[model samples]
Target: MTYTRVCPLAEIPQDGALAVEIDDTPVALVRSGEGVFALSDICSHAEVSLSEGEVYDGTIECWLHGSCFDLASGKPTNPPATQPVATYKVKVEDGDVYVSLGSDE
Candidate 1:
C-alpha cells in the first residue's frame, strides 16, 4: 500500500480524531490515548461521521448510535454496530500523518 499524506500530526488532538478526504472517500484519523489509528469516517450502525465522535480508552464511540469501535482495528466493541468500519495503515513521519488508503489494517 502506498502511503499518502493526510494531515499534520498536530491537527489531531491527543484524544480526538480528524477527517480527511482521499480519493473521494472520507477517512478518520484518530488519536486515542497513546496510539494513532485510521478508519473509515462513516459509522457502521448509521450514516454518521465518525470523525465527529469522541475518542477514548483506545476506542472511538459513534455519536449517532453510541457504538464503540476499537481504533486499532476498526472493529466494533459494543452493540448497535455489528459490522466493522474499514481501517487503513497509518504512519507518522516528522510531524505529518500518512495513510495507505488502498490497504485495510
Candidate 2:
C-alpha cells in the first residue's frame, strides 16, 4: 500500500476528527485518547460527513442520525447504520500522520 502524508498529528484535535481527501477519497482522521485512526468521512446511514460528528471512546457518531462508528473497524455501533464504512491504515512518524487508502484495514 502507498502511504501518503496527510498532515501533522497535532493538526487533529484530541478526541476529535479531521476531514481530509486522499486521491479523491474523503477520509476522516480521528484522534481518540492517545491513538490515531483513519476511516471514511461519510456516514453510511445519512451520507453526511463523519468528521463533523462527535468522537468518544474510540467511536465517531454521525451528526445527522446519531450513528456511532468504531474508529478502527468502521463498524456502526448503533442503529440507523447497518453497513460498515471503510477504514484505512494509518501511521505516525516524527509527529506527522500518514494514511494508506490502497485497502481497508
Best by lDDT: 2
Candidate 1: the clashing residue pairs are none
- Cα error, candidate 1, residue 21 (Å): 0.7
Q: Which runs of model 1 end up more than 4 angstroms from their true locations?
A: none
Best by TM-score: 2
> Against the true structure, what is each candidate's TM-score?
0.94, 0.96
Q: Report backbone clashes per prediction.
A: 0, 0
Candidate 2 total steric clashes = 0
Candidate 2, residues 1-105, lDDT tens digits: the string is 789999999999999999999999999999999899999999999899999999998999999989999998999999989999999999999999999998644
lDDT per model vs. reference: 0.89, 0.95
